[model samples]
Target: MSITEKAHRRSSRSLKALFGVLFATIVLGVTLAGGMSPATAAETPTPAPAPTEESDFTNTYSIGGVLRNGDEVLEGVDITVEGDGFSETATSDEAGEWEVVVPGKAEYTVTLEVSTLPDGVELRNPDAASSVVTADQWLTTSITRSFPMGEDTRETTGFGAQLLQRLVSGLNFGLLIALAAIGITLIFGTTGLNNFAHGEMVTFGAIVAWIFAVLLGVNIFVAMAIALVFGGAFGWVQDALLWKPLRRKGVKLVQAMIVSIGLAIVLRYLYLYFIGGETKAMNVGLSEAVQLGPVRITVASIISMVISVVVLVLVGLFLTRTRIGKATRAVSDNPSLAAASGIDVDRIIRIVWVIAGALAALAGVMLALYRQVSWDMGFQILLLMFAAVTLGGLGSAYGALVGSIVVGLFVELSTLFIPADLKYAAALVVLILVLLVRPQGILGRRERIG
Candidate 1:
């Protein structure tokens, strides 16, 4: 009847509608992941067996390229690839391209026999005349040979080019960290609950994507979408079933934090038990490198960076410009006051949980693509996510973004001077130094310490 009562009624209706939509989306995701859609259920194909660390390289390895004689593409040139226990020979097609798939990872010698070359098209590098290419774990490697019309020769990549390559890699890594850190900061802002199990949410995304993409034969992009939806659903269920009741029971923040730690432990080992300890690769096979100026990167890494930037910008806009976003900010500032002013604090917290889960899952997917998927993948990055949030400021989303990017770059670029294994430690060291200089964090407001 009154304005206050009407607002409460409207909010309740909206909340119910949100829950219903989320539930439907989750069900559809599960069905797709299971390969049980009504249209495909009857003809669902059996999944291929998973690969193990000791699994033999049954898949063929291939390497080829377009051979150019100055500005003209050369053709009909013999490209011989010979290795221990394997040998293959092929002639270049009309396009001047040649490829060979070796059976396994072995030291291979690729030779361009001088007899088969066209007249006056001599090998530019005598060293590359019989080049050795060791095909290791990588799915493929490119071979670029020089055959200039004149006496110009090929040169190795310079130090400046290598530095630029590392910089691009750092940017890619930093963007992924930013994606996950934003979710952590958002949840902390709205609920004031430190979620230790947040890293598990990241693992959940990768694992689900692996299952759907690799096992169920879903398209990789579709599988990632399903994983994101499932992650959001998992968050909603977690809040509805666990944190909501705990809050209603008046559990102290410290006690709740302890509970989250326990939950995290349970989820981590459960993932190990089911997924096993071996690292899992995505179904998407190797991608060729794309050169940009002085740096070269994979297509996946570039796409991940682009997606991270777009999603983060959208989130920033949502937090600043939308009605619910303003209300969420109000609740984060003062829960009791916001509640008294007709803001549904619990609803806002629930929304935050969903958003946090989705973002973390997306981060996990990107991480898995960059690295490999393993049970402890999320655990490994958990500390970095915390550092990002702490360094950015505990409850500031923008601060988390800034902190994550800095940490990502620090972890990557530090490898230049220190051992690669100590890169993570270097990031932590930076975090400590930043805290000493500005205890409130880079963007964190100074709060009462007592």
Candidate 2:
């Protein structure tokens, strides 16, 4: 290449790099200054014009812009409007110009949204801030405004403030569902019966926790402990009184499952009869955010996550290292063989019940602490639990854990593109697709496949 041509290319590259850095800095400043999360980027409100005398009624005003990052125009970008209680949308053409006829008189937000952000660049939307907007001037009837969209902004969350909202929402949903799904998966792995009553077990824990907090006047932590203990105890009693005898009678696995379903209904309404259908808060105030980079997490959420991790670790150790744990695994693998080999299958079953009950209670208490406790909390999570188990492969604790995390994260993240109301539907759809593609589940063993 000629010297002049090489020099020109080098200068262009350097300028592009500098512009990228500048864009990121500006975006960060704009979002952080406004206390808006980076995920919600592309939320810039229109800079209102200076107020003039008369207000003109116009149904729409034309807006056009070259979506660009520095000197380059970005193609295939989505632009949306908000505020004025009405919205209009448009997409950039091949030349990166977009036009929309938006409702006039009131100011509106113009946002640049795309599914993924360009590498090493993040932009924050100014509109996500709590700042209010008011028009100081009226647009000339049928006036056209052109905004010179700047270079792609530098960012960690490439999509900006919208991504942050999605992360938080997903984390919330995943954490909530994990509480119950984990327990269901654990119990199923250890025992052959599908315990439909597991849902009631969770509800019982929440109601008991509520009782302690409301009537006993105990500290929330203490109340939670009480719930956990009582929940474990309930599981023990159910095994001793119902499941154990049924097993001894050589009842079919399907029969045991049916019995569990009946027990679930009985126990569920009994809880409802006593507690009613009202929603109750945990009443423990969690007021601080633990900032990690661009993401802010609350104390309650951190605590819940920590507790789950610790419990799962302990469960892992108990199952792998302890003698009793070995026996439990043996029974799960083959009950008749384990019994014939002198492993105490009945004792293992009882212990499994206790563990399942404890985990269920813990999930219930954590969920209640993070959100509201309701009479139907268990039922609300039942389908999700089924999805996790099916996704993780039936009868695998490790699979369940892995599956729950996947389901939880995806369902939560879907909120970015999907309406919040339809997030659960996305999860089910993903679950069905996963099943079709890999019937054994993500972590399920090939041997376990039908």
Candidate 3:
């Protein structure tokens, strides 16, 4: 054969070898893909991961405030915010501003170091030398907590003026107490359950209002309306999720009461966990105190009293005139008898819960205005609530109204004679006296103990 013909044959063999190598590579790739485990296949990026929730992310929450005495900026003041082995301190800058940035969300103690104050400066209320504030708050841009630095001349007023003021304060306080007492009374009458968690209901209202009025910058009255609606819904939810189910499960009233206590504890802690133990003043603006002779009370107090009275009156009308109200009363009197009379006892009880929740929440909002809203504000007044209920007599709405007023007046007025701290004890003493005189309560009927 010629040299050219030999070269062409060699070229053909090389070309065939290249094609065979390419086919082997393709087959090998297919085999590897087919043999791959699901776990390994998942590693291949076909679908991207979804974005994480805002709560899942860790962001810096700034805890800061200004230290000012009237128009004067007070510098060199040290503020500390501490939580669970983490502590940070910040000194006021030249502009009287101080800030401490913390990681994550948690309840923290924000203390105004009184020792660091200037020689002439002092906290207005020594009792409020330190405040417990939250770190890493959600949906709130401002985390400023202020400590008033001035002399409190509240005690310098004349005796009679103080008395008149106390009376006004008592009236306002009593009305709020009445609102809560009436709710508890209605619930107890219908269900025979001592809902210790009712206080949390109050707190829930206040917190809701705070979220709307303070955090979200909604109007105060609008926030209050939202709070009332939410409060009622919260009550309905409680019955649906917890109380009603337990009732069907044949749980005893005593066990149900215990459950209420546990629920209260859990809710209180949850509030603390989320909102911290801080006292938040819901509305920013302050209403001037109206002077009536020797008496002095805020315009806000008057509005609150008016609102409380109107709501109470409405509640009274509801119980007496409405079909559901009468049904509730009938159920409270005798659940089995009511049920036999073609009344849905569960429905009436649920309505009562809704009313109770709404009323408690309204009271909470007013209380928040009177004294700033706190995580344990409701729990603090739980004793007074029980007292009011007991004083009025069990299962009597009118009695609760009367009892709460009397208790509220006695508590505030007693401060004139007793130490402010001992006033609660004084109120309890009166409750005991009332109980001794009438164990059946002011309005309660005498029922024989089996």
Candidate 4:
């Protein structure tokens, strides 16, 4: 054969081989997508996971606020979501009135700023008349607030009256669940161990809080603190006795998770033996209603939300700022490499367990405050916690927070249409959908897992 023709044939053969290699790679990726080990994927930068929906409840109610400076209406004022179960923001129109749509049965507040309102113009309304609005949020209730120029406070206009009550109730429930779910996600993200005993950890927190509040006659805040400390110690002991030894013995992650299941049952029955399966409330009495517009919210529920936010923020800061926290992040990111780098993997793991336990305890106490406490409280929430962890992505702490919030909102908002009994089922449905479409979760990178 001519030299040119032979060279052409060689080139064609090379091209065919390249195509075959590419085809095989695509096949491998499809077949072993989620099964890949994390170490392998770390060599190549993986795509960020897709964002999850924050809330599924669409706005069905509209509230318009008119801001004015003297005779001129202040146009384009920004209005943000305020109060319970509220999300969404808007800007004013040329007429100085800003209209915002919110989910029905949700409570909201509209605040406007004007340049000419004097140095400290405050507004107050005596009758607290709510504005008229349209809503489709749970039960289709509507209310509104109007801010008149020079008035110290605005009067609510056009509301159906019961809208605020429903919003507050839904929001309180959502926040409590979100708190518990965060702890579940945090542990799962770092340990690679599904701590089934987590439910018991929550129970322990509530029980401790109860003991302080009822038996010992301590303040609620102090009781919560005691519960957190005890919970952390309990977690540390569990790591020292059970998980650390199992890990050192080279047990597989799946095996460790199964062992956790056994521990969960044991702890739960022990709780039953002592606490007696009856529901109990914190001893603090709260009968006062703080009414704004058509909504009436209790002081306790408001306190619960503030505490949840503070805890989330402080934990986030600690993880980002402290050396041990950074080390913990590294270990969670990759334990083998972390150990190779001379980091104390065991210590980090212990710390993670303690923190996780503490958070779980705090969450439990807060939840009991929102509702009533029972031995089965944590067990009832276990599945939802798992859903939040999976939905947010397995090893990302912030992902846990985001996932919990998402799940909480989804559960509460779905009740707008479905029966309250089935709201949690909606969260499960969402979890399944997320797994099918993007198993890596909202904040997880789609990399290999060992």
1 or 3, greater by lDDT: 3
Model 4, residue 219: what's the lDDT? 88
- Residue 14, candidate 1: how far off, in angstroms? 31
In candidate 1, clashing pairs total: 0
| lDDT digits (tens) for residues 1-450 of candidate 4 | 999998788667655544443354356445554554334444687786665577434444556556665566655556665555675666767786667665555555555444333454333443332232333433533444566545544455433454445556666665666666666666665677888888889888999999898878998888999999998998898887667766665566886776778678867765675667678877666435688767777777788878888888888888899998898888878888999999998888888888888988988888777666788888988888888778888777777777777777777667666898998889899999988998889988988779
Ranking by TM-score: 1, 3, 2, 4
Query: Which candidate leads in lDDT?
Result: 3
Instruction: Give TM-scores for every candidate, taking all chains together and pairing residue i with residue i.
Output: 0.67, 0.63, 0.67, 0.62
Q: Cα-based RMSD of the predictions, in order?
A: 11.0, 24.3, 23.1, 22.1
lDDT of 2 by residue, 1-450 (tens): 999998788667655544443354456445554663332244787788765557443344665666555666666666776677877677777777788776666676665564533453334443432222246444453433334433445555556765775677566656556656656766676677778888778778877877787667777778888888998898898787677756655556786787777667766665565556678767666536787756777787778877877777887798889998888878877888999999987888888888888778888887777676887788777777788888988877777777777777887788778897987788889999999999988777777436
Q: lDDT of each prediction vs. the true structure? A: 0.81, 0.71, 0.85, 0.72
Q: Output the worst ten-in-a-row residue range by lDDT, candidate 2.
A: 124-133
The CA root-mean-square deviation of candidate 3, after full C-alpha superposition on the true structure, stands at: 23.1
lDDT of 3 by residue, 349-410 (tens): 89989999999999999999888889999998998999999998989999999889989999
